[model samples]
Target: MNKVKVLTVVLFIIAFIEVIAEYFRIIPLIYVFKPLISIVLMLLYWLSSTKKETLFFLTITTSLITNVLFIPNDLKFIFVGLIIFVFHRLINIYYILKVMKTKDFIPVVLASVPFLIVFFYIFFDTDLLTKEVYYIMIIHNSLISLLGGIALSHYIMNDSSRSSWLLICVLSFVTLHFIIFIEKFYIELQIFRPIAMSLNAFAYYAFYRFILIIERSNSN
Candidate 1:
């Protein structure tokens, strides 16, 4: 691979090390590497593409901000992070719609309904968040479900040989968010925390790969 791809691999290595260090309670290493994870992914995304460059840049930058804000465990910080994440989701929606197949529209919309019901149940029953924050969380969760549905639909409709990469990227995103929900409310077990962080890094790497694959297809 090229320089950007090499850099992407290096970033993933750094992220994996950071997560492992956190799991082992290596505080000094965690403090040094935790904040850099998103920055490295942002740069990786920025360096990896020419097509849809603006949208990809904005998406990763907003995600970086959201991740940074999430480092604080306060409700206020989480609320702000949710807002930023919502913006990022909106951008993702726009990008997905741009390449969406007409035939996939109804399928995508239908697929989102079940996810919406599940998230509504989770958010509505939770006593962890205040009323305002609860509503924000519901909205954020809904957007994530919608984005996943769109990505899934796109992957299904895409006929290209490498379309499976798109599906993998979407799955990584869904997994990352699902782990975030568990980490936020239920339990942050020792085993799961590192897995969550690994998922987060994988989500970014997979998205970068998805973009590269799409760019190559378009060029051909």
Candidate 2:
């Protein structure tokens, strides 16, 4: 078989094995492998696709927001952040609905507002802000993950490249992060922690393979 096909088979095998291992509790690997798996999928997409370009700016922005949100906060900040995330989601849905015939770019601009609010609040309002060198690491890691998702969604959507890519990337990170964060917080709840992490990783790997298929199809 060809390289892409080999890769596809390999991912499926990995997923199958992971599920089996999880069922029997034979493996001791960290359960948080899902996000990393998602990142792997994204990297595969970027490497396989010949026509795509990296959305660096958007990745940076999303990463910064993630770091900011990681800051400790009371209910007040949580409420504000939730509101911002909701606004971002609403704008994203509106843009998705009109993505096909709408080339105006207004929707793209509108969609960015909520994200901007998120980043702004994290950067300016959070007391946990540290301008130390490590913040760069946080930014870098976040961007890589976000960019990976963006690349995957880009390959999946296959159209309306600008908006769908952004929306998916943001939403995926938010969804996965929240789930993982909650799971970590409840370490005693053995059912939710590692299992969710493994599933997240599997989901990410599946997505990565799917995008690889899409990239191969486009190349042909």
Candidate 3:
């Protein structure tokens, strides 16, 4: 009916087609649909709200760039795209810090440290990525840990539905990225690829919801 609802239906429909295409190994139209997810997601959020908050707009735009660049399946594009994503996370972390000033720093560090250690150890041990990309990964993942950790800390501190949804947004990205990492660097898994695509779409939706929650909070 409305723009957001229309895009909501359209987004999941695209996601469904992608999952089916990936699972069934349907090559036709796969590439076209693959990149449409981000475009529609960007539009969904852009049309829904937010022009006053400049940082949020920048985050959405950078996210678009990162997703589009990464879709090419080229190492150079992926590397550059990942670098841009680091900025995306940084913007996110900065935004979270502005709102979350609770005395939960210790908890955030505790929650993120173990995962960071494991991430560094496993990825560094492997020679899968080039030195540059590995360095970028280190920075990118550290920012991710901080972002996710901050979201987790905020959720724990407030125990509100908004914070819970925020955590879900973070988790979607973490989960999908892990699957992509395993699929890319480790072994080529078939089923998980489609699952990841579906989850990626959900991730965007969760993030859109999280943004809307924040928007409401800001206005109120």
Which one wins by lDDT: 1 or 3? 3
Give per-residue lDDT, candidate 2, residue 15: 52
Worst 10 residues of 1 by lDDT: 95-104
Write one digit per residue (lDDT tens) for candidate 3, span 1-220: 3988988999899889988887876766566776777778777877887643666667767877776676557898998898888888888777666654445588888778766776667677778887888788778668777767777777777788678877887888777767777787888867987888777778667767777777777778
> Estimated TM-score per prediction?
0.86, 0.38, 0.85
* lDDT, candidate 3, at 109: 85
> Against the correct fold, how does model 1 do in TM-score?
0.86
| Predicted structure with the largest TM-score when compared to the true one | 1
Q: What is the lDDT of residue 94 in candidate 1?
A: 78
What ranges in model 2 sit over 4 Å off?
19-172, 186-188, 206-220
Over the full model, what C-alpha lDDT does candidate 2 score relative to the true structure? 0.42
TM-score winner between 2 and 3, please give it: 3
Runs of candidate 3 exceeding 4 Å displacement = 24-30, 50-52, 99-104
Ten-residue stretch with the least lDDT total in model 2: 55-64
Quote the lDDT for 90 in model 1: 89
Q: On lDDT, who's better, 2 or 3?
A: 3
lDDT tens digits, residues 1-220, model 2? 3665666565555555555554454444313322223343445555566644343222223322432342333445544444444443333334333322334444444444554455434444434433442354244334334333343444344554343434454455554544544443323344543454355444344433333344455567
